[model samples]
Target: MDEDSSERRWEDMELDILVRIFKTFNIIELTSGISRVCSTWRLACSEPMLWKTLDLGLLKSNYIKIPAAPYVWVSDSSDKRLMRLLKVALGLSRGTITCLIFHYDLYLKDEHLIYTAERCPRLKQLVLPAWNQITKGGICKAIRIWQDLESMTMPSIVHPPYIMEEIGKSCKNFTELKLMGPCDVLFASTLATWLPKLKVLSLRCTVLTKEALILILDSMMHLEVLNISHCVLREVPEPPAPKRVLLELDETIIGKASRLREFYTCLEDSCLMSQRTKADEGLIRWYKYEEWLWRMDEVSSLSVAMEQHVEVGGGGSIVPS
Candidate 1:
């Protein structure tokens, strides 16, 4: 390397400044693009502290345009590019990755998940919304490897017992679970049976039966945080008509579950209206509106789903007249 050019590059962007800039870029750019620039950049990207939480969701917005479905037939070229990116990112992480989040549209095969599980042995939290392509064997393999897994936000499956049993047997520290579909009696019973000591459970935006919910609250003795906001909890006859009501936790049930630090429930018609309008307007993309809602209101006890993209006038709701 020429001394004059090297000196100019260093003066333009120092190593410390370069590290800060690289941190802002998503995993795709860091693994596939930035690190390939030079040896120095690659070294910086390999820093363990920077690879703690590997979020690959931004790649859907940047490169891959997946179909609007749970699973898609990824083109050969895109598949190869994805594998290459994962390999590079996991290689850089060096088994220190604690959290791994995949986009809802990013259809992943068994090989992709296995490769990830092998690389990220210390994985604790995983947010995978789409699992249509992943087989039972694939997920079980990953669970066995990720024994330290604590929290997971995933799509609901038809058969819950297998996965619940696998998680209970393998992941001893698994306490937090979030389901993205209907929470029926079967799901609740299976969960209570296998994971009675569960702490945090998020069933946001799902269709849950009040009986099942109450059963969970009554059965899961060590339950702490329960998030059922935005959920459609059974239908009831509200005098004039049969209106779908959220599971109303009266003072008795609430008092019984006093150990719970947070209990999220959605009964606000305004919030539901805003969500329906947004969905109709095609503003909520990537089949992940529920996930976004949960993230926005996980902390607040009484959070209304207010759309921030557009402005509201007089009324508190975001719906327009």
Candidate 2:
């Protein structure tokens, strides 16, 4: 309100300082003043580095420009609105975005997903959930573009072998993977083979049988934390007497856990009472089978009898020196 205050405000106008200050504004503020200001301010506002990350989630949210500016979708330019944002950010950042996270609910078109993967060449970590149009190959190509990527999460993955192979070949820094679908043995084997440093793996292999489960863990020699709570086949007949959280296949896999630290095989109540009964009966049968197995030089078939013994710790392939 005072004359001195007004004079001081004008005196504080510094072009160099404005450039740094412009970096913090959202898309709207940046564009509104970027070209309108003098060359110095315009250059600062238009810096590609400021646009390295184009988060379309903001468009879905309340923050980003509502119905992005018209010019963003130039009729002649191949890059449309969101695509322009992608290209602009790509140009500005000049390979600065290390992580790109698409909102879980985002329904991307195949074209959108492909363009994004093509543009974000330096992206290191990507998290996309429920992007129905995205296929195994698209993800593989996008991830392969980032050599230093370390983490990824996606939902409803159909096949993981090809994707895992791409990761193995391109991103050696990768160590963490989370998938929210059927965790088959083949996919697990591929991942285990490629990710040597991997320590955490979460697969929704809940209902998988013991045979498939064992095969999955065969390759994860360095796995530490495993959460199979959502697994379908892990329903224990009854809780153990001491009652510690262990999976149905815990006995078979734990021995080969060269670097494992934690394993969770919690289950729902679908098979609660029946599970306990089966577990109790299964425990007794296992010991007898183990005794019989040990009587022979080598057990040929892994029958229920041998399987029972294997489950109850009667005998294992851990031959002592």
Candidate 3:
């Protein structure tokens, strides 16, 4: 056989075959490795199926806490690296990304958020856990651009009305939401006012007030699923009276939630998760515990898939170069 006939060129491979091979590659290899080999490989890397969900769940910022607004100070190098990763990933995605996932520690600035929003115009689901660096205006702007957004896993904010109103006004298809922090009266009331039609909500491992819980159960008549597993449920009496911690839901609360398709509540003191939530002051220190603990949710739609882990440079680590 002739030497040329015996040897096959990767460039000469079919696009379908290349795409199938590319499926095994993680975000790093797809962004930094194969795409630069040649124009054919570049075209394969740009395949729409390859860019549907950009999960940066492994990437985190190196930062220190400061006594100022946006209190955490992320290193300049970390910010630049994130920008580079976003530029490459979004450029190759070609606006086909429907779901975007970020690590709970990957704090992003206004510039990073807006840049992603502008590029991912078709984004339907977003799981962004940290809002320390992002401002209300910044998040609102991003939400407006994501007009098709259907679900989100976000950190609880001081003022929830702005973001809720933005989602209500922009995302008509919005149905699911998960808050990773304490839910107060204002936050619960804001959700009821702006997103009464919300279907699924998860306040797993967070502090949920009795008033907030009751308000949510009563107001969100269209709610199909509610998860408050491992939550620190509290009851506040009339002014001047101290708030009391409740170990279990009362008959009234349970009856009110009976109308929902799924209502998850775990208040057993023996349960490790329940203990952890109580010990940590309603916020589970996920890093110290199992990483999967934070991602666990009784509501299927609100849970993050563990399979989307991004491998960096042939290693198990998710550090992007």
Per-candidate count of clashing residue pairs (backbone under 3 Å): 0, 15, 0
Comparing 1 with 3 on lDDT, the higher-scoring candidate is: 3
lDDT of 1 by residue, 1-321 (tens): 866664457324667777887777766567656887888888788888788888765442322343454334555655565677788889888898998877656678889999999999899988886787799999999999999998887777899999999999999999888776778789999999889889888877667777778789889989888987666667444478864654365676567667687876665657863355234331223345543343343634223232222221122221111
lDDT per residue, candidate 2, 52-159, as tens digits?
554443333211212332211112222234454544444444556665655433445556666766666666656664456566666666666677877666664555
Error of 3 at 200 (Å): 0.6
Candidate 1 lDDT: 0.71
Model 3: lDDT of residue 56? 81
- Model 3 segments more than 4 A misplaced: 2-4, 60-72, 308-321
Model 3, TM vs. native: 0.92
Better of 1 and 2 by lDDT: 1
For candidate 1, which ten residues in a row score worst on lDDT? 312-321
Task: Report the error of model 3 at residue 235, Å.
Answer: 0.8
Name the regions of candidate 2 deviating beyond 4 angstroms: 1-81, 135-137, 204-212, 234-250, 253-258, 268-321
Candidate 1 shows a clash count of: 0
Identify the candidate with maximal lDDT.
3
Candidate 1 vs candidate 3: which has greater TM-score?
Answer: 3
Q: Which candidate is the best by TM-score?
A: 3
Q: RMSD in angstroms, all models?
A: 8.7, 19.1, 3.3
Residue 223, candidate 1: Cα error in Å is: 0.4
Tens-place lDDT per residue, model 3, 245-276, is 99889999999999999999999999888999
